[model samples]
Target: MEFHLVSLILAFKKDTVGIPLAEISYFWGQMGAGKTSIARLINYCLGGSIELSPALQNEFVSAKLTVRLKKGPLEIERGRDSNTVVVKWGEKEDAIQASIPARDANGELIPGTGIENLSDLLFWMSALVPPRVRKSKTKADSETKRLSMRNLLWYCYLDQDEIDSSFFYLDSRDPFSRLASLDVVRYVTGYHDEHILDLEAQLDSLRGERMAMLASIESLARVLRDVGVESEPEIHARVSRLRETADAIFREISQQRNASVSERTTVHALDGLTAQAQALNVRISGLDDAISEVLHARDRDTRHLHEIETLSIKFRRSQSARAVLAGVQFHSCPRCAQILPERPKDNCIVCGQAEIDDIPDSTEEALLQRDIKQRSEELKEIIRRHDAAIIQLRREREELDIKKRRVERERNEASARFDSAYLSSMLNKERERSALQQQADSLAAMARFPQILDSQRQKVGAIQAQEAKLRGKLKDAREAAEKDATNINTLGQLFLDCLVRSEVPGITSSDTVEIPTNSYLPEIHSPGIADNTVVSFATLSSGGKKTLFKCCFAVAMHRLATKVGAPLPGMLIIDSPMKNISERENREQFEGFYNMIYELKANELSATQFILIDKEYTAPVEELDLSLFSRHMKPNDPSKPLDPETAPLIPYYLGN
Candidate 1:
């Protein structure tokens, strides 16, 4: 993906300074002239924390950087000592701006980007899927975390201080950073491809499912043991015996009812009691339906009221946003990256047309507020009425229940008056039948436990089968990727070539650098020195040699990315590359380093953009398409003090 900076704007308390960048820009100046400070400001705007000098801390107001991505131009603005960056994207008239927290994102999605933070937004704008690596390397089934933009920046941005002190953070004291650095190497080298990542995600999910199923099986077994049902067959036999006894009791009760019919002399009285009970039952059912209707109406009204309340809240928030953002104007078309023209008085700042008031009138706002209030009040009143109706219906139903019981008692009394002995026998038989039927029902319910257990076992077997198939597929995908060893070898060869051109001491074209897929660190083998003795970045003692060594590798990485269409941003920023190396003593090495960098920009990396900050300027013989911006800044030295106008960055303060 292409990423190039258009300009860096520093808003100081005294005045604002705009530094325009080109395809190749150079910021060279005297000591303490804020040459390195320019790079630090850019990094800070992009979500890096740097120790600001006292001069800047007191005078600086804010920093803004406009960057052109593949999609369009995005402007990022960060205030002094602020943790959030305000990003403006999209077109001029239809622009969108959101505040994104740099740190402590806590997995929040930025509005309109569908991404969690600035890092994810950058990857999304570049049309690249953020790569994922295992959080814990020791566990194969560990969850994965995304390799963020900050991780990739380790390769792109080389600070003035860290250039000689750090080697791509590979030797970082923090274990997480060290591991992430290794993963970044693996990613750009093509070892962590998309297909392999997808397979890993699938396998992780399957492992979770398998573990859950195993837990469920253990829990079900424990429950069965507690109930004394040792086996499914034993429970089935017990249920069968209970059913047989219940059937015999049912038959005996049926014979007793048949014999009692002849002794029932109060048949007419019994019929009257049945009719009255039927009337009461119908009245109770009517009351139940009335209560249900009232409840349904109340529930529907309550939902409507909730929706209106939510709408009212959103409306108020919208008004607040308008008031806060009033009179904000855009100076550039974010989509096309063009300067905006001045509009007529009272014209729309966005479209440069006549202003059309979109804010609601006071009368309309009042009407809306009144409508919401009235609707809420009406709903409350309806709900109160429904509650009263429900209570009334329940009271009526209770009265009918009393009448129903009285009819039953009267029928029983009339039967006893006719034949007390027969009634007593029938009542005893009915009670016995009820007890037997209840036992049968309970046994039938328990019989379902064995069936449920069998179903659960089947589910577990199915999941295991699926898991086995997925694991096989994942293994095959990984094996296929590991067999293709071309990417890592190519990267290693590029690193060696860059080292030769940069002219690091004790390194030549004959040396070989090996970056194995397992550990993505360069192991140099120089035949002129010691072929058997492996020389790596850690073995390099000279600070100058280390700075050039790290820079050379970074250039080679960008070159490789350009050739293979890797997802590295098309920009590089190097600050104080010659901090430890003096140009007068190391002329050959210094010139060779700049020569190599310019040649790459002119040829293989022609599309790449570079920002170099140093004490001196080096130009190539050949003229490039886009003129390189070389700004020389002078500090306000007290002895032969320079004017504030000479200082291009921060001019007012004296402290470094």
Candidate 2:
């Protein structure tokens, strides 16, 4: 992608200033002349956060940025006090207003009020597919991961404070930011593309799945505690014991049935046995009714418990939202733009609704908290009731089972004693055996729960193995990418060449320059220095050397981008490159730096635009090619400084 800044327009209350950009536009002015402000305005209009001076803040109403992208030209306008931006695409007169709010209001972004965000439109217009980078090297699946044009701006722009800093290339001091900076360089150098991006996405998804499965395993452990199994190994051991118990119970039932059959010949009256059976059946039917009632009560309590839990969650959320709203202080009416009048501490600013006589701020938050507490207590009570109901249901079922067993024993005794009809007694014994067989089957089924848990554990383990494999593949891919010797050598040579051309003290073409494969940062080793002694951008003694090294490294990266056909933004803005260098003492060195930049733009890297903001040109303008510099505001023209008269001022209104 080729990105060039055409102009930056600062709209004042009464007048507007349009700053035209060129291949190398120099905004040379004294300190506090609004030179740096212009650079910051360009950044601000491009979706950056900035703190403007009071003078600029009061004078400027809005800012507009015009850039010529590969697709077409785009005009982006942003007001000082509003979050909305007006984006005009191509030559179309119809501009689309997009919101890019700093914070969400009313569940929507106030700035990006529409479906498309400023980033989306910008990336689309640039014809560049935004790639995803890891937020941290330690955690590839961090949800905070994002890579956009705004992040890329750190590489393209250098403010007055950052031009000579050791970590100027980085956006922040955090380790994650340093890694992200390296990734940005890698991306712009064509070392990363959709392939790396896809791999990262896949790794993220796999990690998510692995985490979810691990969570499920934890939940399963909690649930299985009710069945007395605490872990997978425990479940396996319990399954073995339960299977043996089930087998022993089945054998015992068979033995008892066989013993009852042998004693069937001891005679008794069939009429008496029939009367006893009828009485037993009536008792069993009553027990069945009682068990059914207990089951119904348990189901009702369970439903009530679910409802209470849901209500508790909702009440908690409502209480939190109310507390947040209660602390919000309104200074003005958003709809009417009226300044809110100061009221009593307990009175509402918008509606003038008085608070409770003895309460603070408002009673709403306290009331909501009370409601949440009440709901929490009710939920606990419902849970207690549900648990008690379950215990009662279990007791009833156990008692019913005992009664049924007793009736079966009585039936066996009666059949063995009453042998007047032998065939009928045999048939009755067969029916009793069938009922006992079903009860044994039910017990066996209950015993199989451990096996089911074991199966689930196996499934979770399989997924974990797959996740590990995917992680390995991702790691290998990253390592292979970092080991690209060709890119490292190419970038290293370009960096060294730029440093030599800039005439940086103690650096030459023959000096050992190494671009660390991991960080992609340049390191210089002088000829007479120890093998372990490596000089980096931070180790340089002179501020001018640091600034030159920073600029040269940046230019080298862009030059490499062009060579590799990477989608570089094709623009670089540097502020105060010669802040510490004296024009009288280092005039020759300054001239060399300027000439190097001119030659780079005029010959090799013509597509890339460079904006340099400094105090003044050290060399003659004609010698450096007058066409190379486009002059804007110069605060130190004839050694003049900004004073009260020249600074932006607001008019006072007279009383009527």
How do the predictions measure up, each by TM-score? 0.64, 0.59
- For this target, which candidate reaches the highest TM-score against the unseen true structure? 1
Best by lDDT: 1
Error of 2 at 380 (Å): 28
Residues 621-651, candidate 1: write the lDDT tens digits. 6665445878888777656665744664776
Q: What is the Cα-based TM-score of model 2?
A: 0.59
Q: Which stretches of candidate 1 lie over 4 Å from their true place?
A: 103-105, 108-114, 204-468, 624-626, 638-648
Please report how far candidate 2 places residue 75 from its true position, in Å.
3.0
- As a whole number from 0 to 100, the lDDT of residue 199 in candidate 1 is 70
Give the Cα lDDT of each candidate: 0.78, 0.68
lDDT of 2 by residue, 130-170 (tens): 67676666664453244667767777887777788655445
Model 1: clashing residue pairs? none
Candidate 1 lDDT at 595 equals 86
RMSD value for candidate 2: 18.7
Q: How many clashes (backbone N, Cα, C below 3 Å) per candidate? A: 0, 5
